[model samples]
Target: MKENRSREMYEEIKNITKTFQPRLGVIKDEKGNILTESKQIVDRWKRYCEKMYSSDSTADQQEKLEETREDKEINLLPLRSEIEWAIGSLKDGKSPGCDDI
Candidate 1:
């Protein structure tokens, strides 16, 4: 039992210490130049994300959205009977979904 445990521990340690070399395909910059250095690749990705998601609205737009929200009707929750019907409709003996239901 001790020998088996030691062998398992050795295998675990070997797996942990193994260098993980991920095969990242060639990543190119916006100018179509391939980036090789780690810093250059990271910076190119940062610039891309910034350009892609920089269109967030300003604070004034947020206030306008809040003001408009009050005009919309409030949504009601489903009745207990309706919820029970939905749950009862699911097939039996299958794995539960990510929600565990």
Candidate 2:
């Protein structure tokens, strides 16, 4: 019964995806050039992302890290009572996180 339900859901999702149209029909490059081909669009996206991420200044990052190190101080872990209180305050019926616990 569970397997049949899972199969039905998978087929439903597949049918839905078949009817979907991609929103990004075309992409524009930084030079205002329009890309229609799939390869051109993908390459343009890759170059754009690379240029964007690479534009960050290493000197500014180092200065920011140094400022953070000077200002913040490490703190000890919470008490057992505090931990229990936090867990107890969580509402019931909430879904488990990534660990599924």
Candidate number achieving the greatest lDDT relative to the actual structure = 2
TM-score, candidate 1, is 0.38
Candidate 2 residue pairs in backbone clash: none
Give the count of colliding residue pairs in each prediction: 0, 0
> In model 2, what is the error at residue 55, expressed in angstroms?
4.7
TM-score of model 2 (CA atoms) = 0.40
Off by over 4 Å in 2: 1-10, 13-21, 55-101
Each candidate structure's TM-score, on Cα atoms with residue i matched to residue i, is 0.38, 0.40
Worst 10 residues of 1 by lDDT: 51-60
Deviating ranges (above 4 Å) for candidate 1: 1-21, 56-101
lDDT of 1 by residue, 8-56 (tens): 8889899999998898756999889998988898898899887656656
The local lDDT score (0 to 100) that residue 100 gets in candidate 1 is 43
